[model samples]
Target: MTTLEPAAVADLVRNTLAAHKSLFLATAGSTGPWVGGVYFAESGEFTLNLVLEDRGRTLAAIRENPVVSVVVSTGSPMQPFLQAQALAEILGRDEDARARELLVTKVPEAAPFLAAPVTAVRLSIRKWRATDIANGVLPGAELPSPRLP
Candidate 1:
């Protein structure tokens, strides 16, 4: 697999984030495992922010375990797809305010949930992979590693 430089990876990740509203999150719940789709936002460093129901299964699982995997993809034929293994945790009071602001900008659809009792998760991405990131390549065939520093 080819590897991308930090700047290029950040650019591609940002583009992927901007291009998709939904992301598939995989988590290990106390009962078992789960995968759910959630709307997301990205921090300047590209950390993923998710607003979820406090009592939802995904959140419950997150409380049990912070580790998670997420996939953010672009449907445009010309765009690349990005995925990451991340560690998720509820936001602190200090972080919540800013994260909420950022989240609202990307998904105004989340405004209602922000005011309610909800779980705000920040996924600190550990590893990232991309497809169709190469100049002349087919989508999904190449696993390009984004060695994020």
Candidate 2:
């Protein structure tokens, strides 16, 4: 099995968060079911911003069970493609002001949404893993192989 170095994984995670402005957040619903929602994410040292409608199901689920998982795909349908999935054990309660600031940075178009009544959930990523399928796993480095004869 191919595995990336910690540093490499961290870099990849950072870049993926930066590249993809939005992420799919998955949480357990009140009825013991799984639910997913799209939200604009703002990456941080160990946490990410999940901005959503204040009275939406996503917010309700988070309120019930703070734990959540987020998927940041490469937006490629190809199999074994590079992707970063993070499992975050959310901490504390929603912070509207901070969430608005981060939302503005990540999604300027979301300014209106941020201005409106919304909930900002902070996700503290406890464990996360990233894989580079196209390029072989390396330690803190990404290099494309040159064509050979």
Best by lDDT: 1
TM-score to true structure, per model? 0.79, 0.73
Please provide, for model 2 over 1-149, each residue's C-alpha lDDT reduced to its tens digit, 9 standing for 90 to 100: 45666566667667767777666677776766565645566556356776666677777777787777666665553312222233433334446566667778777877877666666666666545554556654222332212211
Q: lDDT of each model, Cα atoms only?
A: 0.75, 0.59
Q: State the weakest 10-residue window (summed lDDT) of model 2.
A: 140-149
- Cα deviation of 26 in candidate 2 (Å)? 0.6
Candidate No. with top TM-score: 1
Model 2: colliding residue pairs: none
> RMSD, each candidate, Å?
3.8, 8.4
Candidate 1 lDDT tens digits, 1-149: 45556666667666667788788899997789999988888875448887888778989998999889887764454567777778887998878787788889989998988888887788888766666645543333323334344
| TM-score for candidate 2, residues paired by index | 0.73
